[model samples]
Target: MSDALSKPRSTPGTEPKPPRPVPHSPADDIPDGAQVLLAVIGIASAIALLVWGIPKGYHWARAQDWHHFTQWAATIDRPVHTYLAAHTTGLPITAASAYVLWQGIGLGSLALSWATGATGARLTWIAYGAATAWMVWDSSPATGRPVATALAALAWTVGSAFALRGLSLRPVIVNR
Candidate 1:
């Protein structure tokens, strides 16, 4: 008998094996120094902003006159503040309070996102940093502190760059 006949008839169809998947490890989620710094900076900045903003928000909420609140908002010098002031002319104190509250929430979320290494946190952090940089650049000259302002802006930019680089890193978890 021929070798084929001796071996018995083989099936016409056979299942193909799938490629092996790469192994996943907890180490894959470890962030480097820059990412760690980004998280720390983001959390600290968020806390500071919240501390500074909360009282202002409370004051706005308690104030009777929206006009006064809007005026105060306009004086803040930030483009966002100015726009809010211009557009919320007839709104109640809640408008100002809501703006402040919104900032608090956004900052809080930003902090959490960085800490957790959330998927979109990097872009959000970068945007926040850029906005902060712009605000510093816009207002610092008036304070007569060009050098400090420049350094602050540079720091924000660097932080944003760190966030950008950290986009792919995930949150580290402890083994039980």
Candidate 2:
């Protein structure tokens, strides 16, 4: 027999190697243009919240209500540092500083989530829903419209859930 027929082509000892698995990439998992758009909107909204929080913090600080502001912030998951600072600082410092810290942290988180692609986009909406629910629950009594706030929160949660489906956990990549 010819050498080609008599010998195994791969090798005497080594078996054939399996092909390399394609590299898994987050960029490959982007769901669609809608997801990107939603991410942009989420980033924008987080930016707006940061801006809005600044003025509100300033107002509360001027009012000398660090204790009160801190209480509300705790409901919305403000970092522990805000609590420590609130205890140490006078109202003006606490107000401005807490706003910068809390909002900056929140916005930073949202921005990071958006940076992750489809999975991140879905996570952002889920986070937004939970945060909105917590904020509404915390503020409803003060706002004097518990029913309205509850309905609004429900609407927001539903809307966020609907938007979340725009992203797949592992999106099917269509090769053009």
Candidate 3:
């Protein structure tokens, strides 16, 4: 027999090499347009809340008498922060410094969630829209513009529902 024909292709103890893993591409990390839009809305909403909504809310909370919700929030906060007096009521913060801290933490979290494609930021924004709509509905009689309020609430609710469907939980990879 010829030398080529006489030799075996492989030894019994040898094993075949495994296939290589596919390389990751930057394109794979790009989110869909709707997702990006939702992220933008969340970021904008968070900024708006920090800039305007929180200040207004803080003032309102201060002016109002102790409600059940405020009582509950205070009860929960009291244990966590003993420095807050028992009488210190209204949505867990009685001082101007608290608003600053709240704004800083809220903005940082929203930014992180947006950057990471976390479901939390989207969900929180959707909740805010829904809550705003509910509040509009509740106060419509006083506004004396029931039709406009109804329409606004409808838009807010529907928009938030659609956005909820677009929420994503993946960690976004930035393409440098």
Candidate 4:
């Protein structure tokens, strides 16, 4: 009776708990070289456009070459100026030139946004979308070309925004 009472209990069927997954910190996500590359590409493209496009537009405007201006303006897909030019004489080269200048501003903004990794890139997309939409709407009475242009611009803006957001989320690796 004493031996039976002193018997030890034995139950062995349960498995051990598994380890949890490691949580990633921001620092772990983005590499420094990637960040620098993003900044460089954005800034370089913007600078190149500003340097090339603006001067050419200004020269065209100053020369008062309506035909060349009209041709270039047509490439932008805005209906108001193109339509007005077709119907009447003396198309506004100054206005078209101004529009080109605004585009340069957008390019600069995009570069700054990319370099700073701020919300600036998002803002640039919004601006680009707005401009593209305006052109589409203005050209609605015209042919399908303007609509296609608008769609293309919309795609570009959305793609760029995604790219920028992805870059922002990446962790910047610090070298010690």
TM-score leader: 4
By lDDT, the best candidate is 4
Error of 2 at 160 (Å): 5.9
Model 4 C-alpha lDDT per residue in residues 1-176, reported as the tens digit of each score: 69877877555765556898899788667799988898999999899889998898889778884886565445555554454344345655666665565566567666666567567566775676566566555655557666556664755565567536546556899999
- Candidate 1 to truth, TM: 0.33
Per-prediction CA RMSD (Å): 15.6, 15.0, 16.2, 15.0
**Residue 140 lDDT (model 2):** 48
User: For residues 1-176, could you state the per-residue lDDT of candidate 2 as single tens digits?
Assistant: 78779975775668877999999988677778978898999999899879998789888779884786565445444323433354547555665576566456445545554555456555655675565555555544556446534564666555554554445568789999
Alpha carbon lDDT of each predicted model = 0.60, 0.59, 0.57, 0.64
Q: Which segments of candidate 3 are over 4 A away from where they belong?
A: 5-8, 11-118, 142-145, 157-162, 165-176
At residue 139, what lDDT does model 1 achieve? 53
Question: How would you encode candidate 1's per-residue C-alpha lDDT over 61-175 as one tens digit per residue?
Answer: 7775688656433333354454445556777765577558547654664675657766577566666655644554555445644654455556555555544445645788999
Instruction: Evaluate candidate 3 by giving its C-alpha RMSD to the native, one decimal.
Output: 16.2
In model 4, the runs with Cα more than 4 Å from the true position are: 1-93, 158-163, 167-176
Candidate 4's displacement at residue 35, Å, is: 27
TM-score of each: 0.33, 0.29, 0.30, 0.36
lDDT-better candidate, 2 vs 3: 2
Model 4's alpha-carbon lDDT is 0.64
Clashing pairs in 4: 29-171, 30-171
Please provide, for model 3 over 1-176, each residue's C-alpha lDDT reduced to its tens digit, 9 standing for 90 to 100: 89999977898778678999999987568778867897999999999999999999999989988787665444323322333222246656674555345445535545544566457766565555444444444544445436534565555455445444546569889999
Worst 10 residues of 1 by lDDT: 71-80
